[model samples]
Target chain A: MDPVTLLTIVVLAVFVGFEVVSKVTSTLHTPLMSGANAIHGIILIGAIIVAGQASDVWILAVALLAVVLATANLVGGFVVTDRMLHMFRARKPPADTNTDAGTGTGTGTGTKGGAQ
Target chain B: MSLLPAEWTALLYLAVAVCFILALKGLSSPKTARRGNLVGSAGALVAVITVFLSVKLDNIPAILIAIIVGAGIAAPIARRVQMTQMPQLVALFNGVGGGAAALVAVLELGHTDDPWVRVAVVFTMLVGAVSFSGSAVTVAKLQELITTRPLLFPGMRWVMSATLVAAIVACGFIVATGSAGWAIALLVLGLAAGLLLVLPVGGADVPIVISLLNAFTGLAVAASGIVLGNVLLVVAGTLVGASGTILTRAMASAMGRGVSGILFGAFRGGSTAGSTTQSDRPVRSTGPEDVAVLLGYAQRVVIVPGYGLAVAQGQHTVAELATALEERGIQVDFAIHPVAGRMPGHMNVLLAEANVPYESLKEMAEVNPEFKNTDVALVVGANDVVNPAAKTSPGSPIYGMPILEVGDAGQVVFLKRSMRPGFAGIENELLFDPKTTLLFGDAKDSLTKVLGAVKAL
Candidate 1:
């Protein structure tokens, strides 16, 4: 493809893609944007791959550095996001009381913390 | 090898710009945000594919591998993250964008002998690194893996100032010398500066921090795009940066703080030492049966859930109780405060998970008026948002923070373990009110018992 034609196709795609994205409502935003943002990190990988393949020694060195930095961003971003998600995970406290149940029970005044 | 015409390329660029505009517009309303995302992504796809079409790379496999690897990691993580931690997740994602831009700039600098590219590259690296680290610290503070309170040292402001100055000086040297050594030093200093900048911010300030960092990422990405001469990058980054800034300012104002206060860590005084009336006056508590009796006889019951409800994982029990009450022909509604729980829409997500009907969940604005008609306002582990101090006490840390008007309800039943103050550390005056009855225990157990008692009655 000619440079002009290829560039034109890319630009057209951007325009249509932008329009479609704008249609997403506030309700869909949190989930959609989150997914979108994660995908956006692909740029790092792209830059790295592009850099890794450069013919010149200088380009190759630059690409290698890009790979390291971008990888840090990707890894760090994933780790933090995962941790944050854990915070929101619904965890139900087990219905245990101040008593043993292994031998069918022991001492208990009831789980004292059970809101009166 | 190129076969495309110039006019087509120009048209495609215009189309991409349109997609960007549409995506932004759709983001304005929740109903359209999904479609907007699709539109924006399509534009990105077009841009990427067009790049492929124009320039045939020798190693297509490497490019494909990069794409696959990136997606494989990000997709699962995003899928696994829950809704409640979205704010921090957002911060982390923004950080990645900034970091990526910085990395790209650094690589370009390493490869290029041109002074202009080198200068732009340095700027991108500084901005991106700072944005990334700053966002990371904000996420840490918000997640409470690190303390939400400011990590202040004596003369902390001066220290932060000095670090920033050093970073700027280092950046200057890197640009002047065009050496990787200076660049490496500058990166470390910049990272430190970012941490110092965000460390003093408390958890309450995280929303603003997230927004600001988002803006920083956008701007950094945009600068990198300019350096790389990528039009799509420039357009996308600019839109995100601008929108992020606007959102940040709006959120800061909502918390009654300014941008400067947010930046300088001056607003940490929100947690200032204030006298708390620690009432040892024993709470007149009731059992599940007694509480159930009142609720069963009541015509209207409003369920108020807070962070405690979340901590105890009592939403299902709460919903069951609501169902039981409804079965007995008693009216039950969930009253959700805007800033309830840790994040926006936290209550909604919890309730939804428990299969509570969406119609039964009412926002503060919609439910406050009904409190007067409510027979019993059951507060489950909620504190700051329901505290009457928001309206009654000027000196209270939560003063001016909007609260639920559950006080107007005929009787208030508090399901609490103890009188520990909430995130704001201010005692709930509602606890001591004559009309309020404290039901002290585990929220889930209390709720389950209440349901049982109501069913029995």
Candidate 2:
């Protein structure tokens, strides 16, 4: 808990962060931003601790507000990031009449026939 | 005072910090990104649980209620938000984090009497409040609730500098006297400074501004950590601060502008001056049928997409058109600029949603050379990235930035709504080149018409 030790940890973490993130390709930048946004949502812990210790009514209200905002930021960030990442799926199988005939689905036949 | 022994808590904090780092490492590659996100969330879970275990509480019910309410609001927005709105969503989430950090710092002021703790509290409050307000403005701009253009006025720089000086002076006063009143004043001034900082920046620079604000929030969290003596917060916060800073710099350089220039230079209105003269040049126009015929016969084609593509919701149609072209034995590839969409990788996400193959998507450096061999370069709703002005016109705002060499192709087909310039408000000379033909209409409508025309041929 020494100030010097915390400063040392901060400095070293900066180096590690820069090294890891510099390698990120441009295509993944949105997820990278979103993930980091969620990471900083760690501030939620500070909110919880502060709200729990509040004695005055006004201070308690402010602390509760903080807790709500932090929670929203934390949960919202990660879920949105997951949603975005889900969209980056690999290419779907090509539409082939032979494959569609084997499956025998009416919807599948309609789509393939429409494409042609 | 602690539920767990001090050493045990410290060990857990170390584990949490490791998770955070490994999470970022996983994000560096597409293959491991989801797992990385999971790892980071797990670390957050651990950190929150640890806080509950360690802190002695008077209002557990209130805290739980707040958490539930917050999650109730955030979860739905995250779930239902369209992909095009992701940048604004991120900005809004970022604003909440900053507001939370600032509020936490304000609450800590009464609990701590140590001079160092008081100083850290003041630092946290200032940066956190600024980021909160600044990010709000960014959200409004991105959401189109306000004009996305720079809102500059005469003497704006002087007003901003004076406000910054006042905020710093107030912070020093709070640290020196430990007065609550000075601390409140500093927060207000800081919020004003944040607004002033972001208001004059144009829309093209919003991604960089968001990154910078994200870093500000990180530092604010770190300062809060210092006040609370939590090493995990300090480490995690610093890591985010560093990462955000690096990203902001990379994005700025990618656009060939410095951070200071982006913040202040555009305000002089020099970038938009020459646009009128450039627009006077005659441009060649082509219809969708002609475009389809030209594309139908080309052996190889490249598509360059920009923010306009997202605006038109044309990703799915464009992908379908590419497939149609490919069916006719024409090779089709996509060239993505680093800053292509509203955010980085914005186009990729949109295209991927339409099931465009990842292998067919190429970066600027990799795809620029291929343009020379391309029989037809199809630019869909993208102007700035393919603007030859970036390489040739010294007076252009986008000059000196790397661009797609679509002009080198045998034929260039541009799909635009009109002769309007791009986001940077600069005319694209590439549109006027003899090799280039403008196919004007809504991108999706135009692509659909072209698809039908190609089918007929």
Candidate 3:
């Protein structure tokens, strides 16, 4: 890629990154950080590329190790984040997937037995 | 060389990059956050598929095996890890990512002869190594494998400075001579620098260190992208780096510290100043019955939770108590400080895990004004967050950091393990106030007894 193209992507990404997360409430900060952490696990692509093009057995060994580590980072990051978010679930989901912003409606609605 | 045309490959990669942006955007709102994560994962899957489809590769079986092994080890742990240990787990995952990026950059060293690319490779390797080792130290500190207090030494600053200078010289050597030996030297220096950087940070500031290292890894991955000429890598990496930096800044301010101050405070002994002294002053200590009476009689109650609540596994008990209070027609709200848990906002996750309603868990800014009208304020296993010293005492370490203002309530009740101060080790003046009553016991035991007492009332 040319320097100008790469620089443009970088600049735009920095702004987008800042803009997207700048407004997150403090309650969601941990999950947001964890989610971003998992997103970077996409570095598995770089590991795969290195492993595929390894010139010899020694280089292949290191590249494969990279693959394993990157996969864990990516997979575990997402899984853990989802688990955290699951706790912030809708108080009442009757197989209802959309149109329910459980965050605001969660107050004053749960029975003693319902929430637990 | 790739089997697909360059244009097609670039277009596919662009789609993957777009998925990442959408993923982050969805995370801003609670409702869309989970879907956003799924989209991000879909993008990752597409990126992997694109790499395999566009590029003919050898060792297919080995790569698949590696991925399977990594997932097999990670999934079970991620699914079952206790919420209390989530911070350490995050640091560990981040450390491994940094390690992977560093290793990828190392392999790229042999394939590139361009001096600038070499510089990118060096940057990736150096920053990745630092993030990797720095995150590991943070994990150990959080897990109590080592003392959580800041570790300072004679001439440590000089040693840290020397390592940086040496790493720079090694970078020059690698860029100039293209030698693997210089790369090896650089990696060692990077690892040492990581250790030195995290060792002097106290427990209260470990989350900030983790966030900072997370940003470091993002930048490292970006540098790796530059070396591979992969625009997807560049975009994703930069996004994480930027967001992580902002999060770190937000957490520091929430704790009333600056990024540089937390990182370098040990040089002036600020980070090491966690005072463990038990104040000899008399405090009016009571039992769960009195706490129960206080809660039972109050028309409005606010619960201030801290890391200690999680440490004693009292989240469920506390939640039940809140439910019990609400059943009596009392307005119940949980006042959550931003840095209330091992990580910022972590307490909310812990409470949510206990099935507490999200709306009832109010952030500091939203609930601070409500304390005055609150008839009772419950401090459960939390000290520093509710400590009035944050606003009243100028010389206190936590001064200027916002607190839950439990002092404004009609009566304050604390479920404490002892006179031991909070993570910052600052004595809470509110504990000694006439309006406050301390229940001295483990948070879980105390909350359980209080729950029984409240039900009786």
Candidate 4:
């Protein structure tokens, strides 16, 4: 809870985020954006804390609104990301022949393609 | 009873953070991306459940009702939204997150007397309000509920700057005096500034603006976390802030513009004159039957799809045409521009839904060379990516951006609804090229006719 510890965690998290996200391909960019959007839904935790500890009626109302909006963002973000990623199959099964046509090329090919 | 000790709760949050990182790592490849998403969702569940177990609440029914109502609204929309509308959906969800962060900050302001806490509360409220309104405007633009062009006028930049200055001063006053009235004023001004910031941005810039606003919301959440003294919120929010910033920069560079230029460039009125000369040039037009014949006997065909293809929901028809061509021994591949659709990778998702093979979806670099050997290049509702202006015209807005070399193919066929300019509002010189022929119609209808003609042959 100390300022130094929070700052350290914040700095370390930023580096980790950059390292992981820089590797994502352009094809998965939308899902990456959506998934990250969901992660920030951690603010729902803050919302819960505020609502639970509300001392006044107006504060309670505001915190309740926060809780509702945060929950919506959290649930919607993850679900939509799941839907998008579900469409990205490495190999389409023959039974779904109309949709499945090819294998996913590796990251190396993506880099080569991106270089142009 | 408390389900876990504070130490155990912290440990659980740490585990959830690790899951989020792994989730992103998994997203680096198509093979692992879906599982990555599941991992992230699991982390979210753990975090939420851990909070539920730890918090002792008053007004439980109210909380329950809010959760139910929120879920009810969000779930069905997420489940039923078409792929073409995904960007707008993301923007809408992002707006709610920002609004929630701002409200949390508002609640915090009433509870905290500490100066640092007050500052954090004000910071969160300002950033969150801006992001909320900015993202709402972005959604409106993408949904076609508002004009997608830049709504700019003389002195607009000065007006936006003045609003930002006023909001900051209001925030400073609230932090110093703990005045509720000033806090409310700051929130309203912040929201107004957000709207003004996005209003002058044209449609082509919305994706970057959305990404940037996503980063703003993350920072706002982090500020709220500090107000509440929660490490997990701080870490997750910071991670999002970092990733969103990187993505925003990458998207801007992909379009050959800097972030500052994109934010301030006011593009609508300045570029109209540059496009006039090319509009007067004559273009050769062709019918669907001729396009079908031209495509039927081709040894190789490259399909270039753009936002218009997504708008018309023509991915399935294009895929059907490709399959029909393949059945006749013609080789077919798709060339995707990096910034092709409204969002990055937009075209790929649409095509993947239609069952196009991932390997057959080629990037600009990979497919550009192939066009030289291509017997025919079919452009489906795409213009800016194939425009020669990106490479040749220094005065054009898209001059330095990389484009698909569909012009290099032996023959070029464009399926268009009209000669309207693309999102960039620049004339495509390739349309006037002697090697190219325009077949005007709805993309889905034209592709279907081409499919029928090919089948008849």
Task: Identify the leading candidate in terms of TM-score.
Answer: 3
From the highest lDDT down, the ranking of the candidates is 3, 4, 2, 1
* Residue range B100-168, candidate 4, lDDT tens digits: 999998877867788888898899999999999999999999888997877777877788889988988
**Rank order by DockQ, top first?**
3, 2, 4, 1
Candidate 3 residue B454 Cα shift, in angstroms, is 1.5
Q: After superposition, how far is residue A21 of candidate 1 from its true place, in Å?
A: 12
Against the true structure, what is each candidate's TM-score?
A: 0.76, 0.93, 0.95, 0.93
Cα lDDT, model 2, residue B455:
89
Q: Which ten residues in a row have the lowest lDDT in candidate 4 chain B?
A: B269-278
Give the alpha carbon lDDT tens digit for every residue of B1-457 in model 2: 5498778788999999999898888876655676778888888888888888876877998999999999999999999998888889889898899999999998888777788888899889988998999999999999988877788779888899899889889877777777778878988998898899999888878888999999888888888889888888898889889999999899888888888888876666676343533365688887889999999999999998877777888887788889899999999999998888888777887776666767788998899888889999999898888887888887777777788888889999989998877777777767777888988889888988999999899
Model 4 spans with C-alpha error above 4 angstroms: A91-116, B267-281
| Alpha carbon deviation, residue B377, candidate 4 (Å) | 1.4
Q: B317 in model 1: Cα distance from truth in Å?
A: 3.5
Answer with 1 or 4, whichever has the higher lDDT.
4
lDDT of 2 at A18: 95
lDDT of each: 0.65, 0.84, 0.88, 0.84
lDDT string for model 3 (B1-457, tens) is: 5388878888988998888888878866666778888888888888988988887799999999999999999989999999999999899999999999999999999998899999999999999999999999999999999988888889999999999999999999999988998998998999999999999888888998998998898899888999999888998899999999999998998888899988888887643565689999999998889899999989999999999999998888898999899899988999999988899889989988887867788988899998889999999989888887778877666777788888999999998999988887788888899999999999999998999999999
Model 1, A12-71: lDDT tens digits are: 544543444444432222333343343344355346435645777666555544444444
Chain A accuracy as TM-score for every candidate: 0.45, 0.77, 0.79, 0.77
Q: Which candidate is the best by DockQ?
A: 3
Looking at model 1, residue B134 earns an lDDT score of 91
